[model samples]
Target: METTFKNKVALVTGGASGIGRATALAFAKKGAKVAVVDWMENDEMVNLIKELGSEAIFIKCDVSKIDDVKAMVAQIIAAFGRLDYAFNNAGIEGASAATQDCSEENWDKTIGVNLKGVWLCMKYEIPEILKQGKGAIVNCASVAGMIGFAGLPAYVASKHGIVGLTKTTALECATQGIRVNVVCPGVIQTPMIDRLTGKTKEGIERFKGFEPIGRFGLPEEIANAVVWMCSDEASFVTGHVMAVDGGFTAQ
Candidate 1:
């Protein structure tokens, strides 16, 4: 897939770390100019892309806010000129709590970022990609979207929303030169997982046991799926829910 994206532009949100960071570099490696968007300030991400012999820029924006998302797309245009792919990967693993115990703030914030954030990005991004006559989008959901977890009601709901949203949007744009899909990753080894596991040997092992593959997936694995889905190699695929879950979901 190297050089498939030559002279193209790809946008990634929550790209300061983890899967987002991995996908940003993957795009660069494929010769696409990358725009790394994250609420956190991580200069090294952009610097690393430059070191990879690709063009890049960093845009800090809260994807939940319309104004911020609009500005983000605008910055991409200003920096890279056009957009061909997007990975709506900005998300949070909200506080683990039962449905009755989950706070409204937690629910709202989680939904705003994971679900609404993807919607807002697509709302603006589709127009730009339309200008080019063709593009692809991959929204990051999770296995939690397909199944329920006792302590993660909010996260589950938001991701489920992403699943439905992706399908509906894909159908709406299937003939519009834009293909949309969602990725459902299971137990990836990332800062998010670190927080979930409390960085404890026991905590990590407990979660790893959940993976039928017997190991936590690497961020790069998820990045590879997102990149491929956005590539012309996946031209016939759309409205797809891909699980890069190490067989966790199959069980």
Candidate 2:
């Protein structure tokens, strides 16, 4: 978390693609070793980080599972020796259905991955970060975390949970030299959005209208915020729920 430091290492969950991959590369570009964690393995991101002139390793992890999360952090320590920053960015957009029509299965899986997964990552990542004497954590929430959305009961609820959890954890770690915060990204152009929009022009335009900026944000934009939140530049920032939504939340 220090502004000027060396031998720093970072962990990014869901680092296989989108914002995760961007953030992982962002760290690597800054000379920090990175651990790219995702449910599915992608050696490309890892290899790309190496190309950026930094060290990187890909770990296949389902953050929703405790055992997997536990081992994921351990592997990071074993590979990089210490952890200074963490981006708990892994999440899923559950089946879109109205609250009343939402299924138990959808609810469970959504909460498990989006909500419990962040908690589980923090549960294991916090102790390791604490060992380093000082560090920072940035959890990924969403614009949905700030406001209600139709036909996404579970996703909305999980993101809201992340906002609360980040604040609580920030308070707990504030005195211990560990900063905790959450990033509520706006409508970013990523594979997730591609799926949500069905990769169609109309669907994309429909969602793009959701942004007050009159356009969708790139993954690098969100990644920039995440990287800053974990750096000394944001040392005074904790328990902050940043809405990098290009004025979407402003309106």
Tens-digit lDDT string for candidate 2 (62-169): 989999999999999999889989999999999999999999999999999999999999999999999989999999999999999999999999999999999999
Give the residue spans of candidate 2 off by over 4 A: 1-5
Clashing pairs in 1: none
Per TM-score, the best of the predicted structures is 1
The regions of model 1 sitting more than 4 angstroms off are: 1-3
Q: Each model's TM-score?
A: 0.98, 0.97
Worst 10 residues of 2 by lDDT: 1-10
Candidate 1, poorest ten consecutive residues by summed lDDT: 1-10
lDDT string, candidate 1, 1-251, tens digits:
44388899999999999999999999999999999999988899989999999999999999999999999999999877899999999999999998999999999999999999999999999999999999999999999989998999989999999999999999999999999999999999999999999999999999999998899999999999999999999999999999999998899
- Best prediction by lDDT: 1
In order of listing, the candidates' clash counts read 0, 0
Model 1, residue 118: distance off in Å is: 0.6
